[model samples]
Target: MINIQLLNKDFESRVRLGIMSILMVRDWVEFKELKELLDITDGNLASHAGALEKNQYLQVRKEFVGKKPRTTYAVTQLGRKSFQDHLAALEKLLGQP
Candidate 1:
């Protein structure tokens, strides 16, 4: 039997899932790029990213390029492992392995 508890609460939201999914492939992504890719508003992205940050699952970097401010995000090592475990649980739940 599958254990529902294996699923991570931190990634319950599709937004968070998307964020991690993107970061899993790319080294880093800027805030605006993530917003556009996820088709979400600034506030929406910020809130979700904030949650992941609080959980230590993501890294947020803020800096300026010339006069423009830039925010970027990447998955932490803990996040990578957690997300992988979550995916494995999902696959097991689906009877894929």
Candidate 2:
């Protein structure tokens, strides 16, 4: 219901929110780790990640983990700032500020 104005046109999905919420507390997260955390199917996870990636809210690096391809995502400095702003705005909207 437009809970927040959004930091970007993107970064607005519930899945993206979940991913950003978790990443806010960590250095980086693996693709599978995010999928598990959000309890999302592979396709869902990839799509949301793709949106965030396109908006430059995340930095994704694909590599090999034990001969298997692995994707890792990290919040960029801009992303950290944006997330903070987004949270603060949400709080304000909820009359918490």
Candidate 3:
């Protein structure tokens, strides 16, 4: 019988994967920065980000930069640890451990 269990899934969805991938690399990133990295549309990024924020895995800050609005995101401590664990699991699953 083939197993149907999920294995080493870093994210529940692809958009979330992209977000986590970026966060895993940098200490902090701007909203636009993530958008550019994933090449995803604004709405798409927003939706994905919303989910992350809801989980408290990402922290968001909004501020004004000389009359311009700017938004930035940083991975929370929990996020960093979680992503690391996820990666480790993936490596093990792929026989890379």
Candidate 4:
């Protein structure tokens, strides 16, 4: 039987999934750093981040550092739980657990 629970609609996109994956391991990530790592344009990254933020899956913080505005993103507790569940589902589908 197929495991429909393995699918996470919110994480279906490669970009979003990548973002969450990175956030899972890091404390926080700078906007530019994520953009560079994802090799995506400013607008593209913003759109993806916005979606995650809107879903309350991540938190966005904007601060001025030495007169430069810095925007950072971090996964929320809810996000971490959800991502872990999604990963578990995938592992189950793969018969790893």
Candidate 5:
């Protein structure tokens, strides 16, 4: 039987998956960039980001860019590992491994 327990429920959302995909390649991503890239509203992005933060999958940094506040996100090591495991599970599911 194939094991299908490795996928993380937290990352099941496409928005969250997209966030992880972007963060996996870069050290950090700005909130505005994510909002625009995902074509999601502030509240939508914030809600998903908040869920990730609550899961300790990502860290949020808030700072001032000039006078305006800028928020950035970075994936935690645990998050990276979790994402990798999830991908491996997907590959296994597809008989890639």
Candidate 6:
């Protein structure tokens, strides 16, 4: 029997899932890049990122490149483990082992 409870509520949102998915492979991704890749508005990304940040699943860095302000995001150690576990649960639900 598949345990739906094993799935993480924090990653329920597709936006959040996409964010974490991108962060999983990349060391860091800029706000603009993330928005572009996700095909979401700035406010949409900000809201979703804020939720992930609140969960301690992600780290945000803000800095300036010369005169330009820049923001980047990365997944934390806890996030990696949590996301991996979530994937495992999903796989089990799919009967993939």
Q: 26-89, model 3: which lDDT tens digit per residue?
A: 8778888899988999999988788778877789899999999988888888877776776666
Per-residue C-alpha lDDT of model 6 across residues 22-55, encoded as one tens digit per residue: 9999999999999999999999999999999998
lDDT of 2 by residue, 2-30 (tens): 46545444556788899999988988899
Residue ranges of candidate 4 with Cα displaced over 4 Å = none
TM-score of 4: 0.91
Model 3, C-alpha of 40: deviation from truth (Å): 0.3
Q: Can you give the TM-score per candidate against the true fold?
A: 0.96, 0.85, 0.81, 0.91, 0.93, 0.95
Better of 2 and 3 by TM-score: 2
* Model 2 pairs in collision: none
- Position 85, candidate 6: lDDT: 99
Show model 5 residue runs off by greater than 4 Å: none
RMSD of 6: 1.5
- TM-score rank order: 1, 6, 5, 4, 2, 3
Q: List the global CA lDDT of all models.
A: 0.95, 0.84, 0.78, 0.92, 0.92, 0.95
Best by TM-score: 1
User: Which pairs of residues have clashing backbones in candidate 5?
Assistant: none
Query: What is the per-residue lDDT of model 5 for residues 21-72, given as tens digits with 9 covering 90 to 100?
Result: 9999999999999999999999999999999999998999999989999999
Clashes of 4: 0
Alpha-carbon error at 38 in model 2, in Å?
Answer: 0.3
Candidate 2's TM-score reads 0.85
Which regions of candidate 6 are displaced past 4 Å? Answer: none
- TM value for model 6: 0.95
